[model samples]
Target: MSTMTRTPELHPAANLPTRVSLADTLSQTMTMAWRAMLKMRRNFEQFFDVTLQPLLFTAMFAVIFGGAVSGDVSSYLPILIPGLIAQTVMTACVATGVQLREDMDKGVFDRFRVLPISRIAPLAGPMVADTLRYAIAATLTFATGIAMGYRPGGGVVGLTGAIVLAVFTGWSLAWVFTWFGTVGKSAQIVQGYSLMVMFPLTFLSNAFVPASTLPDWLQTFVKLNPVSHVVSAVRSLANEGTITAEVGWSVLALAIVVAIFAPLSVRSFKRKI
Candidate 1:
């Protein structure tokens, strides 16, 4: 007599949870953030933009353009410092997308897909780790300014507020880059496109020069430029020690940016991985 052997079929879904709880999502995101920190630590060159650029640009811009733009280095500190803070932080935000595209290309994010975690965790983790970079860049920028004899009238409290706002802005803006990373064909493409978007936003604004100095048409654009509002808010916080209408506009712009790009990044990231 021959006995027929039966094999039970297994469904992969049986082993996976239908949905990740909020607590689990948070825990998993933190774990992924730790992983990103380790990667950043191994590649110390990642700190160059945040560390070296602040030192070099702050000093170089203050010396070269200082006299030409504001009459002297001392006179330019108030304008240059806050502008540099915004520029440097936005530059840091570009790296978020480039690195993400590189990771995706190297199949790192593919590995993340197998884990039973929230889809957004891997995306959010890198941004969370990037907050440190933003903080370092903002701090070094202020330090370099002070070293050049720039005294912020805002004192410690206002300085603290400015730093916090810059970090938040960088993190929020990073989502735009994150979305690009998910959709870009390659890392270089992501970087090139990100710079294209960033340059106009930074340079066309009131970052390096006064909007009043620009032509009437350009001044109109500068007033409309969101980066100009950010720079103005930062200056108010660091140089004037008072909240201005620019601060409210900046916060509103940041909220709208995050609301739009964050979900788009998550959706695209989910599809890609």
Candidate 2:
């Protein structure tokens, strides 16, 4: 004889919460951003890239190549500072991917998936929090330059514009890295690939030397490099104190990057989970 049996539910559909509203989405994202900031404050060590690296690299590059590049550190400061700002901000963005991967690997984001929050918030909130990294890296680069007697002809207003632009550009690029973080197999792989992309973009551009100094073919690449445009914009604002066409080009590039990567990262994150 067969006995009738009652079985527990295969899924807890009844327990699922309703979709969150837009305001709730915004609120959750901000809360997650605050959470990320709190984690950063507690870990303090995570700030080394935004702080110590900028200071050390700024001095090291100025001392090592200043003489050869511009004939003296004082002369080089103008060229070096703006380029360093672009470079440092980009490097600091690598953390976005690394930390995202770390979270994904450790199952931290698993908890996020269960929450009745916007899917993108857990991904984007940390990115919003990463603006602090951009701010710190850029400010330290400029402060290091000023300490080394690199007085920007641009003065306060110009310096402020350049810093704002750098922060925006860095934040935009970080979206691309965030996409990488979502798709990557692990944190190390993401960072390795990110470094591979970053080093070429930073070093092959006009950041370290005048484009004309490079071979003709390489000069063409440097001229076309978006980073070159960013550096040029910063240099114009910081050194010449002018907001030129270069600034427009840089901003356009940043907008394009954000428009492309923000959606891609969100989609990739949803796929992963």
Every candidate's lDDT: 0.93, 0.89
Per-residue alpha-carbon lDDT of candidate 1 for residues 159-261, written as tens digits (9 for 90 to 100) = 9989999999999999999999999999999999999999999999999999999999999999999999999999999998999999999999999999999
* Residue 196 error, candidate 2, Å: 0.6
Position 135, candidate 1: lDDT: 96
In terms of lDDT, the best-performing candidate is: 1
| Number of backbone collisions per candidate | 0, 0
Between which residue pairs do clashes occur in model 1? none
- lDDT by residue (5-120, candidate 2, tens digit) is 99877667567767888898889889999999999999998889889988998999999999999899999989888888888888888889989999988888887766778987
Worst lDDT run of 10 residues, candidate 1, spans 108-117
Model 2 regions more than 4 Å off: 1-21
Q: How accurate is candidate 2 locally (lDDT)?
A: 0.89
